[model samples]
Target chain A: MQHKMLYVLTISFFKSFYRNRVAFFFLLIFPLIFVGVFGIAFQFSDPLNSPIDIGIINNDEGVSNGVVILDPFQGKIVSAIRFSDRFISIIGNATYPNNTTKLFNVQEYNSSNLELAKSDLENRRILALVVIPNDFSIGFLAALRNIFADDPLLQNITKNWEGYPEPTFSTKIFIQGDQTLQQFSIASTALRQITEEFFSLGSSKVKGVTISTESELTTQGLTVFDYIFPGLVIFGILQTLSAITTLAMTDVESGLLRRIKITQASGSTYVASMILSQLILSLLQLPIMFLTGVMFGFPLSSRLWYGFVIAVILMFGITGIGFILAGIAKNSEAAIGLANIISVPMAFLAGSFFIVPNPELKWTAKLLGGNTIRVLDFLPATPAVRLMRTILLGQQSIKNSWFDLTLLSTLSGIYLIAGLMTYSKRHFQSQ
Target chain B: MHKIYSNGIHAVKGLSLEVEQGEVFGLLGPNGAGKTTTMNMMIGLLKPTKGKITIFGKSIMNNGKEIKQKIGVAPQEFSFYSHLTVYENAKLFATLYDVKNCERRIDELFNLFELDEIRHQRSDQLSGGQKRRLNLTLALLHDPDLLILDEPAAGMDPQSRAVLWSSVKSLVRSENKTIVLATHLMEVADKLSDRIVIIDHGKDLVIDAPEELKRKFGHGETIQIHVKGDLASDEFSLIKAKVKEIWPDVKNSNHSLQIHTDDAIDDLSKLLELLKQHDLKQKIADISLRSETLEDVFIKLTGRKLRE
Candidate 1:
């Protein structure tokens, strides 16, 4: 009868909970919306699955040797400069050789209008923009000619020239885009390096040991969506806890708890029913969150089953928190308010919504080990988020996540015990 | 049992009661008169400051679960899951009580409470009378030996109240279940209860069968006469003196007169004769003779109205 009672109440609770429109929105739809918003924002490099778009305003015209030429590409009357077709070829031919996929999806625009490029940048149609000045080719050839010239008079003339220098050209290269966004910064940096290498080709004598770059084939290449997917899952779990807590508080305020107390229903049975119902809810939220993440271009790693287990454990720990809130709050409104007070800030600090950046203070770093621990690490969500992030990103195996698992388990056990103690202490006091 | 708070507030003090099997016992009290406190203690929801409660010869303090299984309590407040339908609420309670036929029990309760038409409606959407019925139905689902209903008919209409009282009476007679009812309505106590306990300030003032109490604390008969005009002091004294001739104690005011005697059958004639001797019959506009009731007994004991 005791166990059957628990099952009966749990089933009833779920039936009642799903009928609630507010619970429906919070537990299911809200996470999907969150996934959609962050998914679109991080579409580029979504695990390096697609080509990135970058804008280049190539205003460069060929440099003239004492002769001026009008170039429509430049849209300005200036020194006729040569175009670096090799540079364009390098960019166009860049590809992920392992996947046989193009690296960049270039969109060309005429120099007659810069607004089109700026609008694309503002609308996020392009990741980064590069603008080359008209005198670029002229300055490059002049510097090369001076470096290899045998005629003393020509060398003297180029050396004495004040308009441009032999070792460096004043053809200004300006790059525009958000430096904070990793995708934009990566493209802009690549463009800058490519431009530097192209100019170095003009001089044969300039030589240095080549430092080749190699991309690491690992889960570290995860996109922002990979990082945020698990956060949303954890946030969804927190919402489940909040919903359960509010319902529990309502039961208390409505005298339902009191009525059940005088009957054959024991406190353990009631608590068991509440926890079981919330656990079931968390399980339901899991696949929905994962499916939404998949639709948002999140990498569906092979270790998703592992993430599912972690999510269920995370739900267990958080539902205990709901019980604590239910015990402390005077009513449902206060329960929700208190839940928000705990979850919102913890979400941000513990990396559910965003990770709190590590402080740069030396003593602070010393106090909290630079990489091992952080101020937010004390929060249970921190380890839970980390565990989920690791499992979802496939960065590490579940076997290696002992610290996170232990911490989350211990926290869950503590909260469940404390919540039961607090709830029973208050629940048994008759009105 | 005694109930003393940490702050030295005594809600119920030295209150003990015994209810016989197959009897409907009414607990009557004014607001804050410790009725709810005593009921809570009896159901093991509260701990008595002193003394203990026993049900079915088992101490509630130690054998709470065993005792609780046999008792069903319908609290004064609306006490059911508002989010669930009436049938769902009944089924939940039935299952918790381990009723063998859960579905049939829910169906029975729904039909008995006249909630069959709206069995699928959420409890919060029900009318006040319907909510009360649902609350009572949930408590009675287990068919426990002892049933404690605290203001069960509260907020109910006349028809619903009548239905609830009749149902309670039939349950006691047919099932031999012991019922402890707490209410403010003296008429309910007068008509429904075999025995009644009137309490005040957490103390039981009196307890006996309803008729026995009426006979012990109540005047056998009361006579009241309404005068047409305000009686002058001399005329009031003359009427009072005439009534005192037969009944030594006469109650007289400026515009009316009252007399409480042991026998209305014998006192009515003497009362009329006294009114004629004073020539107050011409001044008298209305007269009434009434037998004693629960309200009269309550007021006589507490010296205050039941609602006050």
Candidate 2:
């Protein structure tokens, strides 16, 4: 008899949910819309391969104090050389190795247009600005002579070098931009490496050191959208919170709960029916969101079964929150409002769209194992998102995500128990 | 049973009544008169503040789950899923009640309530009369021994109300199911109830069969005489003194005089002779008589109309 009640209630809830147009909109359409918009906006571009925009200001005066280099055909070639100009040329012509894509889209600037360049940097048109000092040539020559004086082979070349009287000319190359932006950090690092390369041209002892990267998985050509696809799928699953909350509240306000209370069916039977129905609906959301994501350049993986498991666990937690909301809210309108207030922020805090940095104000606990759990780990979405990204994008096996899976299951159990207790106390017990 | 709300309003105070097996018992009261509250307690939806309630010879407070299975309630509000069809709503309740052969039971209820024609339509799309019928149909789907209907014929036209009343009567006559009918409509109570308890301010004023209540508290009949013109102050006093001799209760208003007596037919000739002797026959325009009703009994007991 209990099983029969559960079956009928589950079917009835499922039918009522889908037949209501507003519930249908929230359950599937709203999250699908989010996927479509974010997919189109990202355009499947790789962030690492994108070029950085930078502005260069050359303010160096040419120095020609009898500096000469021996050419093979022309003997003792001597002329005024502007090292700042040469540095700017090297920056403008720099490109990735074996690729035609330029490293930086360099914008030239003069002393008068320096403010304009600064304004561009402020507006994010250019990620960084390079300001060459006026004594760049003198500083370069002096530094070269000093390096020659230390090496025996290059001491003869700089013994008769007559250029600057000072042993060192104080020169500063300023890289300016907003430090908070990621693009600014990349641009500054590249600029510093280029400066070191230019100074090492005259030294024979300096050796170029390059770091080569290799991927453990076959994720060589992945785009930004690939990393964001799993988050979007989890986002769709979270909307079930609002749908279930409003559905339960509708039952309470319509007095359907009271009607069912008079039946032989137990309170657990009704709650189980609700959870089972929403779990089925939440499972359907995973495939639909995955198919939509695949159409938008998201890479398909063979480990979709892992995602299914995570979706079920996450839904248990979400439905638990829905139960609590329905119990506390006075009516369906307030339930909807409270649902949005909880689910939207939870989605963001769980890093559904982008990665959230660790906050300073967090709590940590030590598990039975040697593992430590952070406050964010208590939220089921956190582990669900992590497991999805690892399994789907990283192409890792289920064994690699055991910790997250366990954490998610534990939190889901806690939420479900809490939800059942609150709902039963509020709606099932005698007033 | 006694019920005092958390806000200190005594919704039901020392209210006690008994319902026999296989009888239509009416609970009559005005608005805010604790009818729903009493029914709620009977079904274990509420716990009495200071009294005990037993259903099927078991304490409702301790054995609520066991007792509720034998009972059914049709609440004042429409309490089924509006998005589902009439048949689906019936099937859902039938399943919850664990009715044997669910499909056949639903079919029988549909036929009984005349809901077969609109069984496939969503409940929200049905008319007010159709919705009320569906509400009662779902409650009766389980074939409960004790069925509680709260204002079953409310918000219906005369034809629809008659159909619902006929269906309820059939349920009692054919199935012998005990019913606790709570309503403010005096006509419904008078026609359907085998016995009724009239309550006001959460206390019972009277409880008896309809005929017994009328014979005990009701004035037998009222005789109204409409006159052509208003009587002079002296003339009105003289007529009042003359009518008071026959029947002690005499009322005058709006160029009309009303006299309450044990029999209007027997008193009609005597009243006319008195008016004729007073030389007031020329002023008499019309005369009519009305028998006593349940509403008259309610007014006599509560000093207010049932709807007030």
Candidate 3:
């Protein structure tokens, strides 16, 4: 009833939270770590459009006697080799395996360590590993004959020529298995260019690229962690508020709150104070998480202030939820458990940990509105995210997202009422 | 008159008791007695679980807040906020009680309890006796007309308890504060209560003045004596027979015999005269004669010790 009491409770809210160092770190640090690890795991860099910095390792020897070996595919070997890259190093050092020979390096050994070598290739560590065979001229010529026509004798001779100088022998023509675009395409084009230099192969021999033209998905490369940073912080604040509310239940049971009840401080005033405390907590939580992102170079979109407005609304909404939970919870443990049950799911579903499902869960979002517990629709948080994102990123407006915004606002109102009702419904019994 | 109608199970069983503007009434009971339940009913916490509780001829259920405001309750349990300083704790309750100038009252209580030095100390941090006293102080801070205290001094040490007893005596005797006290301590009830109500197993065992309960055990005395003169073997027997005619419960020894009687002093005077007539000089080692007290009356009425 009194505005002054609300202000006082709001101040106390931060005092209790900050006094607990473990709680402080758990609320702030835990979510940042959650985001960081997830961000790293979900990272995917687009090379052409984005900075796709890759490390390369080349272990290739130059071609022997200028002969290009057939690529190691059986019947499709000719085409596979035709499409398959023969390196002229696009990325690696220009130093060849044999100074006298101009062709790019190839693997001479058929060892098992090549798996590690291939792993490095996919991660873009090695652009290509080219191990040239000792009898490379002989092996290259015989392989080319077999690719020219599938002659059994030429294949047999090619197999024999692929062997080591004396008694050792194994498979040939190994390229990196898990290749990145840069590592892969560079190797293929380089091989094709080298072949052209040796055989006067037309541009036709160079296979055309299969570039896709679908509606391109160009994100700023926001990872799961980055997206969920604000979310986890919000979740933490809500959970802590709920936990505190539960603790306050003792005040009722122990007669302290009952005594308070007999005072001029009405139930409405008491409930409002608690709500104010929680909202302040959630608000404080927001800035902490936002700072984390900002420090980590995850810019709060320039429209962050609008996002801030949504955050305040969310804080109020969640504070209401916390009060409701606190009112219903029989004890501290129950309060904590119930709060987690609400917050954890909301965090995950609201895309605190990932992208909130899009176009919203159309029918459900319409039916449930913001009041729905189904965070998947992001009823409240979805529009909230959009609002925050647009603000942080300095977007024009939340034009088409009217439904989301409406649902969020409506859900907030509903929760606020429910929370107040829940708080007022329970009476303090004392002797 | 305080009207209390307890319905379900009838722990108090529709009991109605009253006192004048300023009177101390004691509720006496052993452990597991219905004193607490009765108190709860009076406070309107249990909703009677059945009956009606009235103070000043108004139903507590209807005038609960008004009645609650005028009454200060100190529960049997130590119910102060352990986390709060004594001053803060009192201030908190004062605020809750809607008392303006709560700081003055808190200061007053702290000084009254002699807790001014450590008013800032948490209640749980206090010694058991100090906590007991503070608990009383909190209730008194509101200056309520009706003070209902239950097991108030259960955990207090003797000195602190004496201090508390004196304060209570002053509150009732000097300040004319009406107090309804529930206690297991017979001595405390005897010293402070103008009238006592004893309950057992959810029933009122007895309700009367402490002297009345004591008188129920009725005029009886047993005196012990040590002989200085060696009386002949039959000499002691003659005196024993004389004392036994009046006392059905009698015990004897070579030098003494204890007799239960209506008048111990008269019986003692006759025996001493008989000693002189028989030419024997006897030593009167001890003679104690007094009205029966609460301890004897409680044991006699309940057929068990009061402490139990």
Best by DockQ: 2
For model 3, how does the per-residue alpha-carbon lDDT over A1-431 read when each residue is reduced to its tens digit?
35554454344445545555676666656656655554455434221222222222233332433223354324332311222223223322332233422223333224446576655544445445544333333333333443334457654644643531222212133333212122233344344344333322232322211212111112234433444445554454445544555545655666655445544446676676666665665566666666666665465555456566677777667766766776788776787788777777666565554443333233564565543333344335545654454334332255534555676787778877987787667654432
lDDT of 1 by residue, A24-139 (tens): 89888887787778878885544443666877777777655654332323444455456544456666667654776776788767787699998787667886776666666655
> Which candidate number has the best lDDT?
2
lDDT of 2 by residue, B126-206 (tens): 998899999998888878889999998888999999899899999899999899999998898999999999988899989
In candidate 2, what are the lDDT values of residues A226-288, reduced to their tens digit?
Answer: 767777778888877888887778778888898999988899999999998898787677777
> What's the CA error at residue A387 for candidate 2, in Å?
3.3
- What TM-score would candidate 1 get against the native? 0.70
**Better structure of 1 and 3 per DockQ:** 1
Estimate, for each residue in B1-308, the C-alpha lDDT of model 3 and write its tens digit.
Answer: 12233333445555556655687898887876677767767766655544566787788778877887878888766766665667766765676566778788788777777888988786768999888888888787777888889888897887888898888887777667889998878888888888998766666767888887776664565555545455666766666665565565666665766555677778778656655766544443444554556766666667777767
Q: How much RMSD separates candidate 1 from the native structure? A: 11.6
Task: Report how closely model 3 matches the true complex, as a DockQ value.
Answer: 0.14
All candidates' TM-scores? Answer: 0.70, 0.74, 0.61
Docking verdict class for candidate 3? incorrect
